[model samples]
Target: MSRPFLKMNGLGNDFVVVEARSAPFRPSEAEARAIADRASGVGCDQIIGIEPSDRADAFMRIWNADGGEVSACGNATRCVGWLLLEASGRPSAAIETEAGLLQVARAEDAADGAKQVTVDMGVPGLDWRDIPLAEEMDTRGVELQVGPIDDPILHTPGCVSMGNPHVVFFVPDAEAAPVREVGPMIEHHLLFPERANVGFAQIKGRDRIRLRVWERGAGLTKACGTGACAALVAAARRGLTDRKATVEMDGGELVIEWRESDGHVLMTGPVAVEFTGTLKDRAA
Candidate 1:
């Protein structure tokens, strides 16, 4: 039987959302990869399953394009949050994920029919073990590099965990960074046993930063919510940028704020519906 699904995106990071509240939708790794295939299937960076949650409004399950299940996805949370709010006609909604529970609410919609969203990503993890580095080290700038022994192409990245691990490398220019070449290298670096999302961040001003990310399992993406949050935190910790900044990515931009009061990261952006369809044998 075919199951219904929705195609959604925040900035340019896309997802295929399946409703599995009543009936579970657990796909095998191969099945997930097939569904995320650009040519043959509904292409998306990740697949999200909205399951029933006793603790929150819904339980969000995330799987990258490579079919690996992960704990968090900030962009997907906004998309799911919009759906829940529309369904319940409520001012706010809470969604649960492997990473933790996220509180979401509508920000402000635009005249162009775009839905604005705000996601309370909770507190970021800064400790060595919080990011789960391979060994003990200061998270402000981990000792790792790529290139020559004396001069490296990239070095001393600030680590942060917005549910998933991310390492932000402050660069002179974001566009000049070899994202495709260096991203995989940093992601698979021995220092990160579970792998990591690699970010190339260029601080444009005290409140603006340009960033590009090579997401683990998903490779290079237009936008990464957690990566953006991590970038802001990393920048703030390094005194490069303020606690709040506009994180510009290839797809678009997001307002990321490291709230000083609660230390929770808030991601504000727009969510869009590309289309919707049915996947054959929806695992219902």
Candidate 2:
């Protein structure tokens, strides 16, 4: 049977959302890759499946463009959260994922009627074992370097887990950082046993930063919500930024705050409904 789907984006980090609450819709890895291919199917950074959950309002399953199932996706969470809120006419919703449960709520809408969402991403993981590096090391400054022995363009990056592993490099200029070239290398580096999302951040101020991310399995995208959160945490750990900051990405901006009281990361951003349709030839 053809499946109805919604296309949504949060700060240009787009998703193809499939509701599987009643019927199971488990796409094979190859099928997911095909669906995410820009030239072949409905292109998106990730594919999200909404299923029933006893612990939360819904269960969100994430599949990257490469068809690999991952534990977390913050931008997609905001998109799905808005959908749930709109459908239930409620102000908040809880979504379960492989990573954990997320509490999402509707914020004030934009002047143009654009919906806004805030997700409680929970506490970030700072321990070396939590980031799950190949070996134990100081997460604040992991022993990784790029470039020549005497001089390296990128080195001693801070590590954090915003549901997924990430290593953040504080660069002088995010635009000048060689994201496309060095990102893949760091993603596949041996230090990160589970691979990792690579973020290049430039601190503009204590409350502002510029970021570019090389998402694992998804390459470079317009924005990465979790990456932004991880960036803020890493920056704070390194004393480069405050607990809260506005992260500017290629797509737009996201407001991320690491709540000091609860130690949870709150990400607030705008979500857009691009379009909706059905998959004519459903994957079996």
lDDT of each: 0.94, 0.94
Worst 10 residues of 1 by lDDT: 275-284
Q: Please give the distance, in angstroms, between residue 146's alpha carbon in candidate 2 and its true position after superposition.
A: 0.6
Q: Write the per-residue lDDT of candidate 2 for residues 1-284, one digit (tens) a residue.
A: 88889999988999999999999889999989988998989999999999999999999999999999999999999999999999999999999999999999999887777789999999999999998999999999999999997999899999999999999999999999999999999999999889999999999999999999999999999999999999999999889999999999998899999999999999999999999988656553
Instruction: For each candidate, give its TM-score against the true structure.
Output: 0.98, 0.98
RMSD of each predicted structure: 1.1, 0.9
Once all C-alphas are superposed, what RMSD does model 1 give against the true structure?
1.1
- What are the per-residue Cα lDDT tens digits for candidate 1 across 106-146? 89776676788899999999999988899999999999988
